[model samples]
Each structure stands twice: as C-alpha cells, then as structure tokens.
Target chain A: MSETTEDIMSATYRALCAHGFADLTMQRIADETDRSKASLHYHYDTKEELLRAFLDYLLDDFESRLACEAADPDERLDTFVEAVFGPAEADDDGDFAVALLEIKARAPFSEPFRDRLVALDARMRETVAAAVRDGIEAGRYAEVDPDDVARFVVTAINGSHVREVALDESPAEARRLVEAYLDRTLDRRSEPEVPV
Target chain B: MSETTEDIMSATYRALCAHGFADLTMQRIADETDRSKASLHYHYDTKEELLRAFLDYLLDDFESRLACEAADPDERLDTFVEAVFGPAEADDDGDFAVALLEIKARAPFSEPFRDRLVALDARMRETVAAAVRDGIEAGRYAEVDPDDVARFVVTAINGSHVREVALDESPAEARRLVEAYLDRTLDRRSEPEVPV
Candidate 1:
C-alpha cells in the first residue's frame, strides 16, 4: 500500500475508535485524516468499502502477530488468550472493543463482513486446535478431540469480549474459567486411570 | 399495561424486527400500528424512549416465563439453554437476533439499556446458581461453586449469541460444548471419589 493509502486507513481507524460505527461519516474520517472528502471517496467509494478494508487490515495484522508469538506450542494457548483479552495498543478507553462490537453488529446484514468474521473465527480455532494436538502428542495434555477443545476455548474468549464490551466488565472471570477448563481437560494426571 | 400501550409496543416490535434498530423511526412504528405519527409521539415521545420501554417489556416477559419453567431444578439448565438458543416467536428471518445485537451494541452508550442488560444478566446467573445449589443439595450433582459455574454458563451463552449474530451461524457447537461442561461439572459419577 502507498503511504497515502496507509494514512487514510489509519485515519479511518482513529475516526471509528472516536465516533463509533453508528455515527461514523466520510466527512468525519476526512477531517480526522486532514484530507478532503473527495480524496477519501477517491480511495474508497463508500463507507462500507472503507470499513471492510479496515477489517482486512486488522485481521491480517492479528494473524501475522499470532503466527510470530505462537511459535512454541506449549505457550500458544496462553499467548492466544492474552492477545484476545489483553489491552490493545490504542485502546486505553476500550474504544477498540466498542468499535469491534459495532462492526460485528453489522455482520448479519453484510455478506462481506460475515464472511470475514467466519474466516477469522476459523483461523483462531485452527490455531488452538493445532496447539492442543501438539500438546497431546507431547503427552503434555490429555487425549481429547482437539477441534472440540479449540471451539470451547474460542467460545469462551468470544463470550469474554462480549461481556467486557456490553457490561463494561473485565475478562478476568472468563480467563479463570478457561484456565480451569484447560486444567481439567488437558491435565492427564488428574484423569482417572482405566482398568487394565 | 393498557391495551393502547400494548398495541404500540407490539407495533414497535414488529417494526424493529422488520427494519432493524439503525433504520427504526417513529413514522415506521406508527405505520406498523396503523396509528398516526402524532399518536406515536404522544405515546413514546422519542425512539430511544420507545426502545427502552420495549426492552423492559421483553425483560419482564422473559423473567416471568423463566420463573414458570424453572420451577424444577433439574430442568432449569435445559430450559435456560433452550430459551437462549431457541427459535424466536417472530423471527422467521432471524431478525430478532439482529435486532437484539443492535440494541446490545448500544448498551455501552445507553444508560437505561445498560442497566436493563445488567439486571437481565444478574437474573440469569441467579437462576443458574439456584439450580446448581438445589442439585447439590438433592445429591443430583457434584458439589461445586454455584456462582463460578453460573458465570461460566452465562458467558458461554453470551458468546454463542455473539458468534451466531456475527457469522450468521448456528449455535450447535456452543450448545454441545456447554452440555459437555455441565456433564463434567455437575455429574456426581463423573467426579473422582475422595480417598478415605
């Protein structure tokens, strides 16, 4: 992407975090970026188009960072959980969560957004599943269906985010629950031995 | 409530299910009820007021129904899960879920909406905790922290709703996962025997 394109995307993100999706406008975005509305329109024809691009940018950034941090299977679960529940770089006021919820609310109506979310969810699940599989193979975790465990982990994380945004609550309880789940399900030492 | 109030509320529900929260207008609500715009204004005063009233109505209806169906402790978990994941009364196109997502998205910014959501969540957690306590007392379930389990259950349900809305996907996986959780946590036989 060109410097101008990158600047526009950053401005869009700032505007979204500031004004939210409901009140976001092209003019507002342009003002945030110190560019004319025509310039924004020239880059992206519509608000949905611009936001969709932003989603793509965010997802790509997340996937790449996850790949880098998740190199060790033993630490993958902790890393993934932290990334999902931890504070964002520019999210001191929790505006990132708010903006995410706003865009997510549109997924049911917008096909592109829905597709992107589906892909993101699948990717996250896959990452967890791989970690679980590796743990089991290394005899560090119990032998369970990796896919099922992955889904449960993802669901817990998603639920935590929802609670955090809608109720202005912390994800501590959710984090603890997931940790308990992992301890119970993955720790083979805690399982009863089968009769020989 | 008066018949007039009920009629207006029903009309508002219909309009919301049709046009969603973003496009909802007093004129559209009046059209749905076959009442004049002036009448709607007299009844609701503003769109937010009408929506807040509708939310209260929905919550009251939910609490009453939950009270009726959750009389049996053994059936309480099943009933709550079904209510959260069941088909809606007026949701042939799944618009009920969409409308709910829209309203929930506003909770962070709308004090009335946030208060109502907090109350609803508390009631749900209390119901689950009560059921768990009763189960333990009756020797039907293992002894566990009812509050912790209740929070986990509520979080799973909330997360499933968020996933369902954002991906337009079914909650089957979430349902199965929660069922597994309850089986593991609540079943006495599944618990390891205490050493004498």
Candidate 2:
C-alpha cells in the first residue's frame, strides 16, 4: 500500500471506531485524513466497502501475530498469549484493545463485521486448542478437554483486554493477571515437578 | 413512575443503546416511544439532562437488582453475580450492556460520564471485594488479594455478557460455560483428600 493509502485507511479506521458506523461519512473520513472528497471517493467508492476492507485488514493483522513461529507447542502458545496480553507496539503505549472493542460493539449492526469477528475468534480458539492438545500429549498439561479448555482460555484472554482497559492497569500488570488466571485454571504448575 | 413516563424512559434507554451516543436524538427517542418531541421535552428539559438522568436511572436499576438480601456474604456475592448474568427482563434484552459500552467509548470526550462510569465500577468492585474477603475469613476461599480478585471477577462477569451475546449457543449452554469458568477460577469445588 502507498503511504497515503495507509494514512487514509488509518484515518478511516479511527473515524469508524470513534464516530461509529452510523456516524461515519465519506466527508468525515476525508476531513480526518486531510484528503479531498475526490481522493477519498476515488479510493473507497462507498463507506460500506471501506469498512469491509478495514475488517479484512484487521483480521489479517491479528492472524499474522497469532500465528506463532515457535516449533515447541508450549513456547508457541505462551508466545501467542504474551503477544496478546503484552503491549501492541513498543513505540505506541496505547493498546489497540479499545479500538477492537469499538469494532466488536458495531458487529451487531453489520453482518460482515460480525462474520469477520466470529471467524477471528474461532481461529484464535483453534490455535489455543491445538497448543493445549499438544501439551497434553507431551505430558506438559493435564488430560482435559482441549476444546473446552480453549474456550475458557480464549474467553480469559479477551476478558483480560477488557479488564486492562477498564482498570487502566499497566500492560505488565495486565499480563501478570492474565498469566495468573491461565496458570490457575490450566494448572500449569501441576505438570511433573520441574525446575524453572 | 407514571406508565407513560416509564415507557418513554425505557424507549430512550433502548435508543441510546441501539444508536451510539453521537447518533442519539430527542426525535428518535420520542418516535421509539410513540411520543412527540414536545412531550419528550415536557418530561426532560434537554438532551444533556436526559442523558444524565438515563445514566442515573440505569445505575439505580442495576443496583436495585444487584443488591443482595442474603445475610451470608458468599450467598450475597452469588446472588449479585446471578442477577448480573441472569436473564434480562421481558422487554429489556441486550440494552444495558450496550449502553455501558457506548458510554465507555465516549468517555474520553466526556469527563462527567467517565467519572460516573469509573465510580460505578469502583462501587461494584467494593461489593465483590467485601464478599470475597468474607469467603476468605470463613475458609471458603483461598487466601488471595481480595481487591485484585474482585477486579478480575467483576471484569469477567461483564465480559461474560459479551460472549453470551456473541455465541450461537442457547442461554442454557452459555450459562453452563460461565458456570464452569466460575467454578474453576473461584475454586467452588470441595477440597480433595490425599490418598491414604
């Protein structure tokens, strides 16, 4: 994408999130991006199409991060979890969680948005489930229903984002809280006594 | 409340929720309630005033329902959780949570609304903390940081509503998932005995 295209998309994303879908307009997006109406219209014919593209970008971004590179399943899951609970970007202190939530809230009104969100959630749950199943096979995790446990873990992860935003806790503190919940619920320490 | 006033107010609440705060208007609320703008202003002076009253009304309604008559702290906590996660009233489904989230999203632009939301969250945390402390004293709960645990639990409860609404499962199935999570995290099961 061209730099200007990136700017236009980012500005549009923020407008939709801040003003919501009902309030978002091409004129508003143009103003937010400091681009002319012609430019905006040339790039995005309609607000709905623009929003559809934004949803695709978001889902792609999420999957790229969550698809961990670790060969070891334990390390892979932990890496994915840390990426989620940890800071989004080193330079930007503000997390994108709030923006993500704003998008979620808009889902009820948009079928495309709801489909993308649910699909992303399902993908995340499967990622966690695969890791848990791997751990069980390796005797690193107790024998439990991987699918059920994945649902709980994914719920906790998303719940942690809400908690962090609501509580205004630091990213480090939020990660610790989420890790604690995982440790307790998954019985991470119960695996055969091993030195740290 | 007069039947007419109650109907109008309820409609306003639902409108504020379905439509984002920026999109909310006196005319829309009046239309929803089958009332005229003149009648809406007859009861509420201004949009700002109406919004303030709406928040207050919601807080009052939530508190009334959340208040526990049980004398036992654990029972009281359980009752409060049940009240929050339980079924909505016949006419009020999915409005409260949406309204809260909309208010939260707009909070950065409105200091007063942000303060009210923060206050409400604090009061909710205090109630949960008091109950958890009592559980610890009675040996029903493990020794833990009551405040932190309360924050965790409250966020979990609120986020549960989102998951419940987003999932395809029936209410019964949703409740089962939430119940399982609570049992695991709260350690609700009786203590296990060591093999002799």
Q: Candidate 2's residue-wise lDDT over A4-62, tens digit each?
A: 87788778766655565546788888887778988888888887788787777777867
* TM-score of every candidate's chain A: 0.88, 0.77
| CA lDDT, candidate 2, residue A146 | 83
As a TM-score, model 2 comes out at 0.81
Model 1 residue B53 lDDT score: 92
**What TM-score goes with each of the models?**
0.90, 0.81
The candidate scoring highest on DockQ is 1
Per-residue lDDT tens digits for candidate 1, residues A127-151, read 8899989888887888889999998
* Candidate closest to the true structure, highest TM-score: 1
Model 1's CAPRI class is medium
lDDT of each: 0.83, 0.69
User: Once superposed on the true structure, which residue ranges of model 2 sit more than 4 Å away at CA?
Assistant: A1-40, A89-96, A163-173, A190-196, B1-8, B14-23, B31-36, B164-174, B190-196
User: How do the residues B1-196 of candidate 2 rate in per-residue lDDT, one tens digit apiece?
Assistant: 6788678778887787667565799998987887899999998999877887776776777788878877676577767667666776666566556556656655545666666667777878888788878877887767778887776666666456555444432344334555665556556663456789
